[model samples]
Target: MKNIKMTIEYDGGRYLGWQRLGDSDKTIQGKTENILTKMTGSEIEIVGSGRTDAGTHAKGQVANFKTSIDMDLPTMQEYLIRYLPQDIIVKELEEVPERFHARYHAVGKKYSYYVWNNVVPSAFERNYSFHYSEQLDLEKMNKACEKLIGRHDFIGFSALKKSKKSTVRTIDEISIQREDNLLHFTFIGEGFLYKMVRILMGTLLEIGSGITALEVIDTIFESGIRSEAGMTVPAQGLFLDEVYYN
Candidate 1:
């Protein structure tokens, strides 16, 4: 068997998320697997570095799968490009060691949440960005990010009812930048809880808009309560920018 690795990019506007549902083809993983199955003449399941939630796009998402088909990467790439849905793109493909599992071997991930902070919204970016027509205090938002940028019990930021695994994760960085009317919030971390990035974005938006105190990040960390954070922002604004192995 050959272990294949690939970088995937997709516009997650119409899918039910990455995980394959029971007989549902409206998912990135399901769509990709279906094509792989057709190529291999057997059931083929690929493992992603992580799941990008529904309506969340990806630019450099990673995945790996074991295939016994005696095929070259170029031929496989051409096959996928010609057969898979238009929105999904296999950026690159290569053969790797059999032990390289995408999710298990992942070292870090980078996610970006985009906000359109303009008086008027863009007609093209409606599906890719969150529109908030209000002034945000970037200085205050940076302050909150400082408190959030370390290893901590992020049980409060997560959406799980109860975590079977540890909620402690290290956030290597979180920073914001503005260009024209767009505000980009980038998050780099070891790993994130379910919906944690969205939830954290919501909290920062509230703080940046002065709806919540900047120090609330500290309070949420201490309280370990989900309600202490702001609303879970919409998934359309989130993007899985990259997954790191080292």
Candidate 2:
């Protein structure tokens, strides 16, 4: 069998995330698998780098699958583009080494969150960004981002109730930028726990709004209590920007 790697981009507004569900076809992985299975005339399961929550988008999501099909990469990609839903597109495809497992081999990931901060809502960008009306203190938010950088237990910032695996993850950078009425937040990290980025965004927003003090991050780290952290932001604003492999 030959291993094939694919880079996917999806709007993710109408899907139930990336994983395949037995009862539903409303998933990115399920849709891709269905098309691949039909093309290869065999059962095909693609392994994704990671799962994005429902309504979350992706610009550079990666996956891999093993297949005995002898079709060339271009033909296979064209076939996928021809049949797969317009919202989900396989941007790139190539034959990969047998040992290249998408999830296990990922060394780091980058996520981007967008917020439409304005008194009036946007018609076109409503589905793509979170609409926040209140004024945000960027200086305060940047200060909070500094505190969240580096290695720390992030159980308080995630939705995970329990896990034997360590919750500690390294956040290399958190950048906050504004373009007109849009606020862009980028996170580069080794790995992130479930809902960690959304929760972190919420905390930072609260700090910016003066609803939560800057010291709350230190308190959450010390307590490791989920309730002590801020609310989990909506999924529509988050995007899985890229996955890095080495």
Candidate 3:
């Protein structure tokens, strides 16, 4: 069997998340796997680098699958593009060594959250960004970012109720940038727990709005409690920006 790695880009506004579930065929993974199974005439299972919640987008999501078929990469990419939902597209595909496994091999990932700070509605970015009319202090937000950039037990920031696995994660970088009325938060990390990025963004947004003090981030860390953090931001504003591999 040959292992194939594919980089996909999708507008997740219309679909369920990346994982396949019995409840819906609108998931990105289920749709792509169904198409590939039909084309290859075999049961094809694709392992994604990670799962993105419903309504969250991806610019460079990665997945790998093993197939006994003899088709080349370009052909498979073309076939996927043609058959999968219009919102989902395979930008690149290649045959890789049999040992490669997308989820396990991924070393890190970058996630970005967009916030529209304008009062008026954005026609073009309406679906991709979350609109918040509150006046945000960018300076305060940047200061909070400093505390977020480091290795820490992020159990307080994650939406996960319980886990036997370690909640510690290393955040390489956290940056907030404003371009006009749009605020972009970039988070680069070794790994993230369930809804971690969204929860972090929510806390940052509260700090930006002066609703929460700058010291709250440190307090949340010291407390190690989920309720101490701010609300979880909407999924529409989060995007899996990129995946890193060694």
> Which candidate wins on lDDT?
2
Clashing pairs in 2: none
**TM-scores for the candidates:** 0.98, 0.99, 0.98
The residue ranges of model 2 lying beyond 4 angstroms of the native Cα positions read none
Rank order (by lDDT, best first): 2, 1, 3
Tens digits of per-residue lDDT, candidate 2, 155-208, equal: 999999999999999999999989999999999999999999999999998898
Any idea what lDDT model 3 has?
Answer: 0.92
129 Cα displacement, candidate 1 (Å): 0.5
- Name the candidate that leads on TM-score: 2
Per-residue accuracy of model 1 over 222-245 as CA lDDT, tens digit each: 998999998899999999999998
Q: What clash pairs does model 3 have?
A: none
Write down the TM-score for model 1: 0.98
Which portions of model 1 show Cα errors greater than 4 Å? none
Model 3 C-alpha lDDT per residue in residues 23-104, reported as the tens digit of each score:
8898999999999999899999999999999999999999999999988788888888889888898999888999999999
